[model samples]
Target: MTNYNAVFAATFAAGAGVMGMAQTADAQHAGHNNGMSDFDVYASSEYGFCDAKKIASVWGQSIWEGKMTLANKVRAGLTDLADADIASAEGVRCDWSEAELTYADATQLASYWGNSIEEAKSKVADLMSGMGHKRFVETFADAMADQTEGDEYDVGGNFETYVASSYGYCDAKKIASVWGQSILDGKLTIASKVSAGLTDLADADIASATSVSCDWSEAELSYDDAQRLADFWGNSVEEAKSKVATRMSEIGHKRFVEAFDYVLR
Candidate 1:
């Protein structure tokens, strides 16, 4: 079997600018066990070569960094060991862990995909459906390290935060529009509609929604944000709006119809 302990020891030594020919034979044949019981078993199993390579790269880097606890390194090392495609795509010599060593620098990716980190992670996670939670955390650790510096498990926390942000069945605009139209359609006076729509909403959302609700306003959904929404929903603006409308309460839809008739008067 290939000696992964020696391989990682060399890689770790290289990162620290240390190299000794004698250390090679020593690590390979004579080094004491470092308690990698699972890794040893994994390296000896069928199809362990590629998986061993991936784990060693990450494990070595974690060791060289000398910041993470040993347990954390072992936990981190187990990630991304099964993604043959990701490894192949990266390079003959590179896995996701290796790629991340240089940093994927996901800020640019995030910017290209969406307005926020949460949106970026959502889009990425959708595309990488097979990626596990541990692998995802390890892969995006650099981007998150900067965003949530000073936390021990910032990357994991950021991952959870992004996933949570991606999930709401409704968005601010959908909620506001439904509520606004409902108030407008109510038996209550016109004054009540405006007041209700404007209530508890941020000035920015209200301003934008008002522009959307009032056909006369030149300020529509800005091209960039609209494009982002279209990309995220994978639908045209009209289609997305229609979908949002379907998700509204029946009373909310009825309110929109009543409000439309009132406006026609």
Candidate 2:
């Protein structure tokens, strides 16, 4: 009634203008610091103003030296630096981003690699380019857990070759956990649990069964029993074995003696 359409258009135009100015300011600020743009610094996530400022400062000091691809990696929590590092970098009045591996993950990774974080990060960058962050972390963690003595064993090379020749990280980790690091490192030529007709299960299932020393291959349960065990107790084949064994033992001397005899045999 009161030229509402015109009013809406004006309001929209004014909002757009304000947004344009803000973006311009951000771009200018980014240019003054480095070749980074406002989009580069803040477009990755929904970070607040202070967080954006902190990320910008950190990127300028630490991550700017690396490839632009590394910005997403930093955002993904792969960098050793954290919020604290951002604060420290800001306080130092430094021109370069002094991003280093200062976080707990860095420490764990460094210890696993038996090298400093800087050295580990170089390898990690390579792994990240191909395997991605999650796969890289899982593969490295598997390798580390299996490693007994080594400063480093050309893990990047090993991972590349392994993935190319065989399956991906999850399968590789499962094999490595069962067969040992020697299999992955090429000390041992070939091993196959799967080839032997072993039941292929999730890593959690295998881990749980193995923890309780359950032989999944030989253990047999009805579908209902397995489902109940899985859903109620969160039991793997191995975990269910003890419970089943106890129940069988108790029931064998009672009405289910024939069934127990068959099971025992």
Candidate 3:
């Protein structure tokens, strides 16, 4: 549940399978994105009238909040909150399953676990030092998922960045100039070709600083997926990659941080 790559990639591949060769140029175009997987990842446009830059402002707001959350969590001494939260949340998310649990039920579960939502959330994990790990696991069943405090939220969308090169996909060029500068400055002088390539396009629209939102929305983590992630822990392929971004930051990896560092900066 914590691996960024495994968590999000599994969701993406599961939700939107490979596009395969299309029949027409236009249909091929919608396959791009704005939720469509086009040949480019820089997000040119999709469905004919899509605008990549229009949402720049929104992404910026998201980044601000994300950075603030990370900062606040650190201050609260909940350095591992995101990981635990994401894993527990993912473990019990409501998207892919039909278990009678409404969106309200999800939020309510958070409340039921404790007086304050944060305290209640902390109650979600066994690793959590508080009073409720075993209870949380038993009550939520095997469905709910939450990221470990060990991981941070990662932005795994923007498919163009990862689509294999042989296909000539578009990559986001926005320099992550705002987010994680120190990491980039430490070990790696430049980013990988795929990331570096997107720098120009991501910068073309200097709307707002963008940070990753819930990369793996509750919609993506069904009960079964959450169960699998929790069961695998660090063992399986999908469970581990699910939270790469957070782990990268935790392990303080120079290479992984380089991926999102330039997007906001």
- lDDT string for model 1 (1-265, tens) is 1222333333333332111111222233222245433223222222222233333344443111111122233445543333433243232242222112111234445765555644554444443333422355455555444433333243333222212221111222333353442211111122233235542333333333432232100111122323444566789965644443442222232233233333212
Better of 1 and 2 by lDDT: 2
By lDDT, the best candidate is 2
Candidate achieving higher lDDT, 2 or 3: 2
- Model 1 vs. true fold: TM: 0.21
Supply the global lDDT for candidate 1: 0.31
Per-model TM values vs. the true structure: 0.21, 0.19, 0.20
lDDT of each: 0.31, 0.33, 0.28
Model 2: per-residue Cα lDDT over 1-265, one tens digit each: 0111122223322332122222232323332224433234333222222232344455652121222223444445645444343344334221101111112334466777799966665565544333332234446655434332332233322232332222222233233345433223221111132233332332332243232221211122232343455555577744664565454333211122233333332
For residue 171, what is the lDDT in candidate 3? 11
Model 3 per-residue lDDT tens digits across residues 1-265: 2222233234333443222111111232343223433322212211000011112122332221232333334334564553344343322222111121222234455654545634333333222222122223344643444433432232233232333221110111112233322211111112234356753433332123233222322111222333444454645534533563333323222222234333211
Ranking by lDDT: 2, 1, 3
Model 1: lowest-lDDT 10 consecutive positions = 214-223
Predicted structure 2, TM vs. truth:
0.19
